[model samples]
Target chain A: MKTKERSSENKICPLEVAVNSISGKWKVPIVWQINEGKKRPSEFLRGIAKVDRRVLNQQLKEMEQDGILTKVSFNELPPRVEYSLTELGEKLVTILWMLNDWGKLMIPAEED
Target chain B: MKTKERSSENKICPLEVAVNSISGKWKVPIVWQINEGKKRPSEFLRGIAKVDRRVLNQQLKEMEQDGILTKVSFNELPPRVEYSLTELGEKLVTILWMLNDWGKLMIPAEED
Candidate 1:
Protein backbone atom coordinates (compact mmCIF):
# COMPACT_ATOMS: atom_id res chain seq x y z
CA MET A 1 0.00 0.00 0.00
CA LYS A 2 1.09 3.60 -0.60
CA THR A 3 2.29 5.46 2.49
CA LYS A 4 -0.87 7.54 2.55
CA GLU A 5 -3.13 4.50 2.35
CA ARG A 6 -0.98 2.52 4.79
CA SER A 7 -1.37 5.21 7.43
CA SER A 8 -5.07 5.62 6.71
CA GLU A 9 -5.81 1.94 7.17
CA ASN A 10 -3.38 0.59 9.74
CA LYS A 11 -2.95 3.62 12.04
CA ILE A 12 0.14 1.74 13.19
CA CYS A 13 2.99 4.07 12.25
CA PRO A 14 5.92 3.73 9.87
CA LEU A 15 8.17 3.17 12.85
CA GLU A 16 6.16 0.11 13.79
CA VAL A 17 6.52 -1.32 10.32
CA ALA A 18 10.26 -0.75 10.56
CA VAL A 19 10.13 -2.47 13.91
CA ASN A 20 8.03 -5.42 12.72
CA SER A 21 10.49 -6.34 10.01
CA ILE A 22 13.11 -7.22 12.58
CA SER A 23 11.24 -7.50 15.89
CA GLY A 24 11.63 -11.26 16.22
CA LYS A 25 13.45 -10.67 19.55
CA TRP A 26 16.57 -12.48 18.44
CA LYS A 27 16.89 -11.17 14.90
CA VAL A 28 19.15 -8.19 15.65
CA PRO A 29 22.00 -9.82 17.51
CA ILE A 30 22.02 -12.68 15.06
CA VAL A 31 22.37 -10.22 12.20
CA TRP A 32 25.08 -8.36 14.09
CA GLN A 33 27.05 -11.51 14.88
CA ILE A 34 26.71 -12.68 11.29
CA ASN A 35 28.07 -9.36 10.10
CA GLU A 36 30.92 -9.80 12.56
CA GLY A 37 31.83 -13.04 10.67
CA LYS A 38 29.94 -15.66 12.68
CA LYS A 39 28.57 -17.58 9.67
CA ARG A 40 27.67 -20.98 11.02
CA PRO A 41 24.61 -21.79 13.13
CA SER A 42 26.81 -23.43 15.76
CA GLU A 43 29.13 -20.42 15.91
CA PHE A 44 26.10 -18.19 16.41
CA LEU A 45 24.97 -20.45 19.24
CA ARG A 46 28.39 -20.30 20.88
CA GLY A 47 30.37 -17.08 21.42
CA ILE A 48 29.57 -14.40 24.03
CA ALA A 49 26.30 -13.64 22.18
CA LYS A 50 23.97 -16.52 22.98
CA VAL A 51 20.40 -16.71 21.70
CA ASP A 52 18.05 -19.52 22.69
CA ARG A 53 17.80 -22.12 19.93
CA ARG A 54 14.05 -21.86 19.43
CA VAL A 55 14.08 -18.04 19.12
CA LEU A 56 17.23 -18.08 17.05
CA ASN A 57 15.71 -20.50 14.57
CA GLN A 58 12.55 -18.45 14.40
CA GLN A 59 14.45 -15.23 13.75
CA LEU A 60 16.65 -16.89 11.16
CA LYS A 61 13.59 -18.12 9.33
CA GLU A 62 12.03 -14.67 9.43
CA MET A 63 15.21 -13.01 8.21
CA GLU A 64 15.21 -15.38 5.28
CA GLN A 65 11.60 -14.46 4.66
CA ASP A 66 12.53 -10.75 4.73
CA GLY A 67 15.16 -11.50 2.09
CA ILE A 68 17.71 -10.09 4.47
CA LEU A 69 19.51 -13.41 4.54
CA THR A 70 19.61 -16.80 2.87
CA LYS A 71 19.80 -20.15 4.67
CA VAL A 72 21.60 -22.96 2.91
CA SER A 73 21.56 -26.50 4.20
CA PHE A 74 24.08 -29.19 3.36
CA ASN A 75 22.99 -32.81 2.90
CA GLU A 76 25.80 -34.23 4.97
CA LEU A 77 25.82 -36.55 7.97
CA PRO A 78 24.33 -34.65 10.95
CA PRO A 79 23.35 -31.95 8.40
CA ARG A 80 24.79 -28.44 8.44
CA VAL A 81 23.10 -25.08 7.91
CA GLU A 82 24.60 -21.68 7.22
CA TYR A 83 22.95 -18.25 7.12
CA SER A 84 24.25 -15.29 5.16
CA LEU A 85 22.85 -11.94 4.15
CA THR A 86 21.68 -10.83 0.75
CA GLU A 87 22.94 -7.54 -0.66
CA LEU A 88 19.89 -5.76 0.73
CA GLY A 89 20.48 -7.25 4.16
CA GLU A 90 24.11 -6.19 4.14
CA LYS A 91 23.02 -2.66 3.18
CA LEU A 92 20.81 -2.52 6.28
CA VAL A 93 23.84 -2.72 8.60
CA THR A 94 24.88 0.81 7.70
CA ILE A 95 21.46 2.09 8.70
CA LEU A 96 21.55 -0.10 11.82
CA TRP A 97 24.84 1.51 12.77
CA MET A 98 23.10 4.87 12.81
CA LEU A 99 20.38 3.44 15.08
CA ASN A 100 23.07 2.00 17.33
CA ASP A 101 24.65 5.42 17.56
CA TRP A 102 21.31 6.89 18.52
CA GLY A 103 20.80 4.22 21.18
CA LYS A 104 24.19 5.02 22.69
CA LEU A 105 23.26 8.71 22.93
CA MET A 106 19.89 7.97 24.53
CA ILE A 107 20.80 6.75 28.00
CA PRO A 108 18.83 3.69 28.98
CA ALA A 109 16.36 4.81 31.64
CA GLU A 110 16.79 1.55 33.53
CA GLU A 111 19.27 -1.29 33.53
CA ASP A 112 17.88 -4.00 31.25
CA MET B 1 25.40 -1.51 27.01
CA LYS B 2 28.27 -2.08 24.59
CA THR B 3 27.03 -4.10 21.63
CA LYS B 4 29.16 -7.03 22.73
CA GLU B 5 27.99 -6.86 26.30
CA ARG B 6 24.41 -6.29 25.23
CA SER B 7 24.54 -9.43 23.16
CA SER B 8 26.15 -11.40 25.96
CA GLU B 9 23.43 -10.28 28.31
CA ASN B 10 20.19 -10.06 26.37
CA LYS B 11 20.94 -12.36 23.42
CA ILE B 12 18.50 -10.26 21.40
CA CYS B 13 20.14 -8.88 18.26
CA PRO B 14 21.09 -5.38 17.09
CA LEU B 15 18.30 -5.60 14.55
CA GLU B 16 15.94 -6.04 17.51
CA VAL B 17 17.53 -3.01 19.15
CA ALA B 18 16.96 -1.10 15.92
CA VAL B 19 13.36 -2.23 16.09
CA ASN B 20 12.97 -1.44 19.82
CA SER B 21 13.89 2.22 19.42
CA ILE B 22 10.69 2.83 17.49
CA SER B 23 8.57 -0.27 18.14
CA GLY B 24 5.76 1.44 20.04
CA LYS B 25 3.26 0.24 17.38
CA TRP B 26 2.02 3.75 16.53
CA LYS B 27 5.29 5.68 16.62
CA VAL B 28 6.35 5.60 12.95
CA PRO B 29 2.99 6.68 11.55
CA ILE B 30 2.82 9.53 14.04
CA VAL B 31 6.33 10.62 13.15
CA TRP B 32 5.54 10.33 9.44
CA GLN B 33 2.38 12.38 9.80
CA ILE B 34 4.25 15.00 11.81
CA ASN B 35 7.02 15.26 9.24
CA GLU B 36 4.32 15.63 6.59
CA GLY B 37 3.32 18.79 8.54
CA LYS B 38 0.59 17.50 10.82
CA LYS B 39 1.95 19.27 13.92
CA ARG B 40 -1.16 19.49 16.06
CA PRO B 41 -2.29 16.44 18.03
CA SER B 42 -5.86 16.74 16.76
CA GLU B 43 -4.68 17.06 13.19
CA PHE B 44 -2.69 13.89 13.76
CA LEU B 45 -5.76 12.20 15.17
CA ARG B 46 -7.72 13.36 12.16
CA GLY B 47 -6.44 13.33 8.58
CA ILE B 48 -6.91 10.14 6.51
CA ALA B 49 -4.73 8.43 9.13
CA LYS B 50 -6.95 7.56 12.09
CA VAL B 51 -5.10 6.43 15.21
CA ASP B 52 -6.98 5.45 18.36
CA ARG B 53 -6.53 8.11 21.02
CA ARG B 54 -5.25 5.67 23.61
CA VAL B 55 -2.64 4.18 21.27
CA LEU B 56 -1.77 7.59 19.87
CA ASN B 57 -1.40 9.06 23.33
CA GLN B 58 0.67 6.08 24.42
CA GLN B 59 2.89 6.28 21.37
CA LEU B 60 3.25 10.04 21.72
CA LYS B 61 4.24 9.70 25.35
CA GLU B 62 6.79 7.06 24.45
CA MET B 63 8.23 9.13 21.62
CA GLU B 64 8.64 12.03 24.00
CA GLN B 65 10.36 9.64 26.35
CA ASP B 66 12.60 8.44 23.50
CA GLY B 67 13.76 12.00 22.78
CA ILE B 68 12.36 11.59 19.26
CA LEU B 69 9.68 14.22 19.90
CA THR B 70 9.04 16.91 22.45
CA LYS B 71 5.56 17.52 23.79
CA VAL B 72 4.66 21.14 24.41
CA SER B 73 1.46 21.77 26.31
CA PHE B 74 -0.33 25.08 26.72
CA ASN B 75 -2.36 25.41 29.88
CA GLU B 76 -5.41 27.10 28.43
CA LEU B 77 -9.10 26.38 27.85
CA PRO B 78 -9.34 22.96 26.14
CA PRO B 79 -5.56 22.76 26.65
CA ARG B 80 -3.41 22.86 23.52
CA VAL B 81 -0.74 20.25 23.04
CA GLU B 82 1.86 20.28 20.24
CA TYR B 83 4.40 17.59 19.39
CA SER B 84 7.51 18.23 17.37
CA LEU B 85 10.76 16.44 16.72
CA THR B 86 13.99 17.24 18.48
CA GLU B 87 17.11 17.72 16.35
CA LEU B 88 17.85 14.00 16.74
CA GLY B 89 14.25 13.15 15.92
CA GLU B 90 14.47 15.18 12.74
CA LYS B 91 17.65 13.37 11.80
CA LEU B 92 15.88 10.00 12.22
CA VAL B 93 13.34 10.61 9.44
CA THR B 94 15.83 10.19 6.61
CA ILE B 95 16.74 6.78 8.01
CA LEU B 96 13.06 6.03 8.48
CA TRP B 97 12.53 6.73 4.80
CA MET B 98 15.06 4.04 4.03
CA LEU B 99 13.11 1.61 6.23
CA ASN B 100 9.93 2.61 4.39
CA ASP B 101 11.61 1.83 1.10
CA TRP B 102 12.54 -1.60 2.39
CA GLY B 103 8.96 -2.26 3.50
CA LYS B 104 7.65 -1.39 0.07
CA LEU B 105 9.88 -4.04 -1.39
CA MET B 106 9.02 -6.80 1.16
CA ILE B 107 5.51 -7.70 -0.14
CA PRO B 108 3.25 -8.26 2.84
CA ALA B 109 2.78 -12.03 3.06
CA GLU B 110 -0.83 -11.54 4.10
CA GLU B 111 -3.31 -8.70 3.96
CA ASP B 112 -3.86 -7.15 7.39
Candidate 2:
Protein backbone atom coordinates (compact mmCIF):
# COMPACT_ATOMS: atom_id res chain seq x y z
CA MET A 1 0.00 0.00 0.00
CA LYS A 2 1.18 3.54 -0.71
CA THR A 3 2.02 5.81 2.19
CA LYS A 4 -0.49 8.57 2.90
CA GLU A 5 0.38 11.76 1.07
CA ARG A 6 0.61 15.03 2.95
CA SER A 7 0.33 18.36 1.18
CA SER A 8 3.68 20.10 0.66
CA GLU A 9 2.45 23.32 2.22
CA ASN A 10 1.33 21.79 5.52
CA LYS A 11 3.94 21.21 8.18
CA ILE A 12 3.69 17.81 9.87
CA CYS A 13 3.23 17.45 13.61
CA PRO A 14 4.40 14.02 14.69
CA LEU A 15 2.14 13.98 17.73
CA GLU A 16 -0.90 14.77 15.60
CA VAL A 17 0.10 12.20 13.01
CA ALA A 18 0.57 9.54 15.66
CA VAL A 19 -2.80 10.28 17.21
CA ASN A 20 -4.54 10.35 13.85
CA SER A 21 -3.06 6.99 12.95
CA ILE A 22 -4.68 5.32 15.95
CA SER A 23 -7.83 7.44 16.33
CA GLY A 24 -10.25 4.84 14.97
CA LYS A 25 -12.64 3.38 17.60
CA TRP A 26 -11.41 -0.19 17.42
CA LYS A 27 -7.84 0.54 16.32
CA VAL A 28 -6.26 0.54 19.78
CA PRO A 29 -8.17 -2.55 20.88
CA ILE A 30 -7.11 -4.26 17.66
CA VAL A 31 -3.49 -3.40 18.36
CA TRP A 32 -3.91 -4.58 21.92
CA GLN A 33 -5.40 -7.86 20.70
CA ILE A 34 -2.57 -8.41 18.21
CA ASN A 35 -0.03 -7.61 20.88
CA GLU A 36 -1.60 -10.35 22.98
CA GLY A 37 -1.08 -12.98 20.19
CA LYS A 38 -4.51 -12.93 18.56
CA LYS A 39 -3.86 -12.72 14.80
CA ARG A 40 -6.97 -13.62 12.83
CA PRO A 41 -10.07 -11.48 12.31
CA SER A 42 -12.27 -14.11 14.00
CA GLU A 43 -10.03 -14.07 17.07
CA PHE A 44 -10.23 -10.28 17.21
CA LEU A 45 -14.03 -10.37 17.04
CA ARG A 46 -14.08 -12.77 19.98
CA GLY A 47 -11.56 -10.71 21.95
CA ILE A 48 -12.92 -7.21 21.50
CA ALA A 49 -16.57 -7.22 22.54
CA LYS A 50 -19.12 -5.06 20.66
CA VAL A 51 -17.06 -4.71 17.46
CA ASP A 52 -19.01 -5.75 14.36
CA ARG A 53 -17.38 -7.64 11.49
CA ARG A 54 -17.52 -4.82 8.96
CA VAL A 55 -16.05 -2.23 11.37
CA LEU A 56 -13.32 -4.62 12.42
CA ASN A 57 -12.40 -5.30 8.79
CA GLN A 58 -12.25 -1.59 8.01
CA GLN A 59 -9.98 -0.88 10.97
CA LEU A 60 -7.75 -3.79 10.06
CA LYS A 61 -7.48 -2.56 6.48
CA GLU A 62 -6.70 0.99 7.59
CA MET A 63 -4.02 -0.17 10.01
CA GLU A 64 -2.47 -2.27 7.26
CA GLN A 65 -2.43 0.75 4.97
CA ASP A 66 -0.85 2.80 7.75
CA GLY A 67 2.00 0.24 7.84
CA ILE A 68 1.23 -0.86 11.38
CA LEU A 69 0.19 -4.38 10.39
CA THR A 70 1.20 -7.08 7.89
CA LYS A 71 -1.45 -9.44 6.53
CA VAL A 72 -0.55 -12.89 5.24
CA SER A 73 -2.97 -15.25 3.56
CA PHE A 74 -2.56 -19.03 3.44
CA ASN A 75 -3.70 -20.86 0.28
CA GLU A 76 -5.32 -23.93 1.88
CA LEU A 77 -8.84 -25.33 1.15
CA PRO A 78 -10.34 -22.98 3.75
CA PRO A 79 -8.36 -19.76 3.33
CA ARG A 80 -6.74 -18.43 6.44
CA VAL A 81 -5.40 -14.90 6.96
CA GLU A 82 -3.20 -13.68 9.78
CA TYR A 83 -2.06 -10.23 10.88
CA SER A 84 1.05 -9.30 12.80
CA LEU A 85 2.62 -6.12 14.04
CA THR A 86 5.48 -4.65 12.03
CA GLU A 87 8.58 -3.17 13.69
CA LEU A 88 6.85 0.20 13.80
CA GLY A 89 3.80 -1.46 15.32
CA GLU A 90 5.93 -3.07 18.03
CA LYS A 91 7.29 0.37 18.87
CA LEU A 92 3.71 1.60 19.15
CA VAL A 93 2.95 -1.13 21.70
CA THR A 94 5.61 0.38 23.96
CA ILE A 95 3.81 3.73 23.82
CA LEU A 96 0.45 2.02 24.34
CA TRP A 97 1.79 0.40 27.48
CA MET A 98 2.83 3.78 28.81
CA LEU A 99 -0.57 5.20 27.95
CA ASN A 100 -2.19 2.28 29.77
CA ASP A 101 -0.18 3.03 32.87
CA TRP A 102 -1.17 6.68 32.67
CA GLY A 103 -4.76 5.56 32.32
CA LYS A 104 -4.52 3.56 35.53
CA LEU A 105 -3.65 6.75 37.36
CA MET A 106 -6.72 8.44 35.93
CA ILE A 107 -8.94 5.88 37.62
CA PRO A 108 -9.85 7.05 41.11
CA ALA A 109 -9.01 4.92 44.12
CA GLU A 110 -11.86 2.86 45.54
CA GLU A 111 -13.62 4.55 48.44
CA ASP A 112 -13.27 3.07 51.92
CA MET B 1 -12.69 19.11 41.19
CA LYS B 2 -14.64 15.90 41.70
CA THR B 3 -13.42 12.86 39.80
CA LYS B 4 -15.57 11.61 36.95
CA GLU B 5 -17.91 8.81 37.86
CA ARG B 6 -17.68 5.54 35.99
CA SER B 7 -20.54 3.10 35.93
CA SER B 8 -20.29 0.06 38.21
CA GLU B 9 -21.28 -2.38 35.49
CA ASN B 10 -18.73 -1.24 32.94
CA LYS B 11 -15.13 -2.28 33.29
CA ILE B 12 -12.58 0.43 32.71
CA CYS B 13 -9.96 0.16 29.99
CA PRO B 14 -7.08 2.45 30.87
CA LEU B 15 -6.02 2.89 27.28
CA GLU B 16 -9.53 3.75 26.21
CA VAL B 17 -9.88 6.16 29.11
CA ALA B 18 -6.58 7.82 28.24
CA VAL B 19 -7.58 8.23 24.60
CA ASN B 20 -11.02 9.57 25.52
CA SER B 21 -9.46 12.09 27.89
CA ILE B 22 -7.40 13.63 25.14
CA SER B 23 -9.75 13.19 22.17
CA GLY B 24 -10.77 16.82 21.99
CA LYS B 25 -9.41 18.67 18.96
CA TRP B 26 -7.09 21.10 20.77
CA LYS B 27 -6.41 18.93 23.83
CA VAL B 28 -3.03 17.61 22.71
CA PRO B 29 -1.88 21.03 21.56
CA ILE B 30 -2.94 22.52 24.89
CA VAL B 31 -0.99 19.83 26.72
CA TRP B 32 2.04 20.51 24.49
CA GLN B 33 1.79 24.21 25.23
CA ILE B 34 1.55 23.65 28.99
CA ASN B 35 4.49 21.25 28.87
CA GLU B 36 6.48 24.12 27.38
CA GLY B 37 5.71 26.28 30.48
CA LYS B 38 2.92 28.34 29.03
CA LYS B 39 0.88 28.72 32.25
CA ARG B 40 -1.74 31.31 31.51
CA PRO B 41 -4.62 30.96 29.05
CA SER B 42 -3.38 33.91 27.03
CA GLU B 43 -0.04 32.21 26.62
CA PHE B 44 -1.69 29.03 25.33
CA LEU B 45 -3.79 31.08 22.91
CA ARG B 46 -0.66 32.65 21.49
CA GLY B 47 1.49 29.50 21.38
CA ILE B 48 -1.06 27.27 19.60
CA ALA B 49 -1.83 28.69 16.20
CA LYS B 50 -5.40 28.97 14.81
CA VAL B 51 -7.17 27.97 18.06
CA ASP B 52 -9.95 30.37 19.00
CA ARG B 53 -10.65 31.50 22.57
CA ARG B 54 -13.82 29.44 23.11
CA VAL B 55 -12.33 26.17 21.88
CA LEU B 56 -9.15 26.71 23.87
CA ASN B 57 -11.05 27.35 27.07
CA GLN B 58 -13.15 24.23 26.57
CA GLN B 59 -10.11 22.03 26.05
CA LEU B 60 -8.34 23.54 29.04
CA LYS B 61 -11.42 22.94 31.17
CA GLU B 62 -11.68 19.33 30.05
CA MET B 63 -8.01 18.66 30.72
CA GLU B 64 -8.32 20.23 34.14
CA GLN B 65 -11.35 18.08 34.85
CA ASP B 66 -9.51 14.99 33.68
CA GLY B 67 -6.78 15.68 36.31
CA ILE B 68 -4.16 16.44 33.64
CA LEU B 69 -3.99 20.10 34.63
CA THR B 70 -4.27 22.09 37.83
CA LYS B 71 -5.88 25.49 37.48
CA VAL B 72 -5.03 28.40 39.79
CA SER B 73 -6.90 31.66 39.88
CA PHE B 74 -5.53 34.84 41.46
CA ASN B 75 -7.93 37.29 43.13
CA GLU B 76 -6.40 40.32 41.42
CA LEU B 77 -8.61 43.15 40.09
CA PRO B 78 -8.44 41.54 36.68
CA PRO B 79 -8.39 37.86 37.60
CA ARG B 80 -5.18 36.06 36.77
CA VAL B 81 -5.45 32.36 35.97
CA GLU B 82 -2.69 29.85 35.41
CA TYR B 83 -2.57 26.17 34.48
CA SER B 84 0.18 23.69 35.17
CA LEU B 85 0.51 19.99 34.56
CA THR B 86 -0.09 17.69 37.51
CA GLU B 87 2.15 14.72 38.31
CA LEU B 88 -0.13 12.66 36.10
CA GLY B 89 0.10 15.29 33.41
CA GLU B 90 3.92 15.22 33.61
CA LYS B 91 3.87 11.47 33.09
CA LEU B 92 1.64 12.01 30.07
CA VAL B 93 4.26 14.39 28.65
CA THR B 94 6.87 11.62 28.63
CA ILE B 95 4.45 9.45 26.65
CA LEU B 96 3.70 12.33 24.32
CA TRP B 97 7.43 12.74 23.64
CA MET B 98 7.69 9.07 22.71
CA LEU B 99 4.63 9.41 20.47
CA ASN B 100 6.23 12.42 18.80
CA ASP B 101 9.32 10.36 18.02
CA TRP B 102 7.17 7.55 16.58
CA GLY B 103 5.37 10.13 14.46
CA LYS B 104 8.69 11.11 12.88
CA LEU B 105 9.01 7.59 11.50
CA MET B 106 5.63 7.86 9.74
CA ILE B 107 6.93 10.65 7.54
CA PRO B 108 8.31 9.36 4.26
CA ALA B 109 12.06 9.73 3.71
CA GLU B 110 13.07 12.53 1.38
CA GLU B 111 13.41 11.36 -2.24
CA ASP B 112 16.65 12.00 -4.12
| Docking quality level of the chain pair in candidate 2 | medium
Which residue pairs clash within candidate 2? Answer: none
TM-score of chain B of each: 0.74, 0.87
Worst-scoring 10-residue span by lDDT in model 2 chain A: A1-10
- lDDT tens readout by residue for model 2, A39-82: 99999999999999999999999999989999999998799999
> What DockQ does each listed candidate score?
0.28, 0.74
* Superposed model 2: Cα runs more than 4 Å off: A1-9, B1-9
Tens digits of lDDT, candidate 1, A1-112: 5757754665554445556877666677777878898888788888535577777787888889878998999999999888888886887777788777666656554465
Per-residue alpha-carbon lDDT of model 1 for B26-110, expressed as tens digits? Answer: 6777888889988887888885355788878888888887788998999999889998988878877877887776655565544
